[model samples]
Target chain A: MTAATADRVVAEARVCVAAVLDPELPMITIEDLGILRDVQVHDGRVQVTITPTYAGCPAMDAIRADIEEAVHRALPDHGVDVLTVLAPAWSTDDLTDAGRTKLAEAGIAPPGVSRLAGAGTSTTSRAAVALELSIRCPQCGSPDTRELSRFGSTACKALWVCRACSEPFDSFKNH
Target chain B: MRSTCEAVATEAEYAVALADDALVASQRLVEWVARAPQIEEDVAIGNIALDLLGQARLLYQYAGSLTDPPRTEDDLAYFRDERAFRNVCLVERENGDFAVTMVRLLVLAAYQRELYDRLARSVDPTLAAIAAKAVKEVAYHRDHARQWVLRLGDGTPESHRRTQTALEAEWPWVSELFDGGWLAPALVERGVAVAPASLEEPVLAFLREVLDEATLAEPDPRPAVTAGREGRHTEALGHLLTELQHLARSHPGASW
Candidate 1:
């Protein structure tokens, strides 16, 4: 493949991998979790960078294997390498707005931007900070939820019990 | 021993020391997978356990790579006799309750956080690099444990009582972590290891903050009885190892 073709193929492979659902949270893709970082194609090999959900998350190995398989299947003749990076810690804040919306829609409440939302900014042009600090319940659309545990299923989410509905649910906590 | 490069023993010992703690604790933590009080906590602890396991793999692999005898991580983790294993006995203890487990985690993670932070700047390049990466994970571990200690200690009368008892029970083991045997001092002399004693104040301060938040009092410090690094593990590790290595031992060369 040519250089330009390889780059396009690499980008396409990333999008394909992004469609792969997380085993724990089937609603969100690994990419939606912001675990996928960079993709590059060199020679006949395609290198992909993914930050782990947590330090020792078992899902990472599975995710890597899945990525490699998916990429290889997508680009038959190219080799794929999945690189795990641990420098900058993974945070729920890295979730894209669309990802958050997907999570909220799936009934797993996404984290609210407490620091950003409470900054008292009125002009909403993607200001780095806004006043949307309360995590609304995906089930009940209420902000009256209490944090039960800092850790949730798979170590990437936190346990939050909603007060309005009296139902316990998981919230993807910020790192 | 040779002068400069002759420091092999210290490097190997340091790696074993950290790896032992990680390996044993990880074994214990993985037990809580489906048995946790809640699914969220189950995954959380499992994740932490997994992190420690990773560290163990790296440290043990690094140690194996360095030593001429060439022992793999599995060899050091499973095949070694008790006397050859250098992990602290405290880490090998059973997970009593959520409170007990959290207390142990709080103390160990806090200590490890400081240890890794200092080791991140070690003269040994490998140790420094591993520590730098590990520091981030350990920080999260410390936070997870800290948050639990607070919640359990201050939650209710029952939770407070349980968490306090757990804290006191685990306090005796804290001393052993700060005083390493011959290996620790050697590494310290070479500027490759942080003295466990220097970590005491910061660790204590962090613990105090958590305890205070939990509405719990700091337990009086007692002189710890040492044995872990010298290979004197609790009876728990033997059982733990038996369970962990069962499949691997039973099905030799069995890959599923």
Candidate 2:
């Protein structure tokens, strides 16, 4: 294939893969979740790289399968490969602004900014960052919320109860 | 090629040791899913277990890649016998009560946070990557256990008593975690692994601060007979393996 064609193929594959939704949080696409790391096309073959939100996310397998299927459907004759990388570790900070909006609309509080952005520089300072940042309640947009549990329905979230609305919701825990 | 091969073997062994720790701990924590004191606790413990399981899966998969014939994560996790496992004895101890679980978690998470922090700089890229991601998760785990320890250790009289007792019970196992066994020293020399012994000071300091904050006294230092690193384990490990591996072993190649 021509260079231009290959570039187009890579771009097309990215769009296809990016459109695949997270299995657990169905409203958000893998791209929006920042899980879809990169898409490259070389020698008429496409390679897609992804990072997991959590180490043992059960949804990773489904996400992989979904990416493969979507890419194959988009480029019928091209070979598609999905790879999961662990380095430069994933952070909730990777989530897109669009993703944050989608999460709030779903009544799940998105994670706050990560404290580990430059973590390797100093371990002690990194650990000193407090985990209990105030999270706005999605239901009533109330800042008056209390953490009921450090864990929620899934590993990625924590349970919080909004004092104003008396509603319990999940806040995507910051990494 | 010979040196490369040897390095791969050493790295595989080191990875197995790390994986086993998370795997056994996950099994113990999974028991609290429905049995915890409250629904919130049930979810909390289950989330912690799942995180451990995730770390275990990554390590197992990395270890499998370095093996001679290569193994899948499932093969390493579900097919291995207790005698072949290489986790520290601390994680293999059976879960006692809620207090016991919290104390055990507090100690283990503190150690893991230090271990992972150091391992993130490993020469082995895959191991370093795993450690970097794992350190973040373990930070949460450590904080969770610390919170509970503070509440239970300083709360009611009954809670204080139970938590203190549990801390003492779990203390003997803590020394074993700092023991740098045969493979560890060699890996540490090569920059492929962190020296377990080096993690002792920081881990203890963190735990001491947590204990002090909770108004709980540090337990007397008494080391247990350490053998899990050598594949010898407490009887509890065998029973745990039986329950964990039963269905998978009974129905080979089974999948939902």
User: Best by TM-score, which number?
Assistant: 2
Give the CA lDDT, 0 to 100, for residue B222 in model 1: 86
Q: Write the per-residue lDDT of candidate 1 for residues A1-175, one digit (tens) a residue.
A: 6778766887787677777777777777877878888888777787889886655566777788888888878888889888876545465667878888888888787876534321112211122222224667779888987877666665566677888998888777654
Candidate number with greatest lDDT: 2
Kept native contacts, fraction for each prediction: 0.35, 0.62
How close to the true structure is residue B92 of candidate 1, measured as C-alpha lDDT? 89
The whole-model lDDT of each prediction reads: 0.76, 0.86
DockQ of 2: 0.57
Tens digit of per-residue lDDT, candidate 1, span B1-256: 2355433346787798899899888888888889988776777888789789988877898898888888787777767777777888789898888888989888888788778878877898878767765765676677778778888888999999999899888888888887754353557888988887888887887788778878998889885676777677778878888887887777766655
> Which candidate leads in DockQ?
2
| DockQ of each candidate, alpha-carbon based | 0.23, 0.57
State TM-scores per candidate. Answer: 0.78, 0.94
Candidate 1: pairs in clash: A56-B51, A116-A130, A117-A130, A117-A131, A117-A132, A118-A131
lDDT of 2 by residue, B80-138 (tens): 88878989888989888799999999888888888888899899999999998888888
Which segments of candidate 1 are over 4 A away from where they belong?
A1-20, A112-133, B1-9, B30-48, B61-72, B95-99, B120-168, B184-192, B211-221
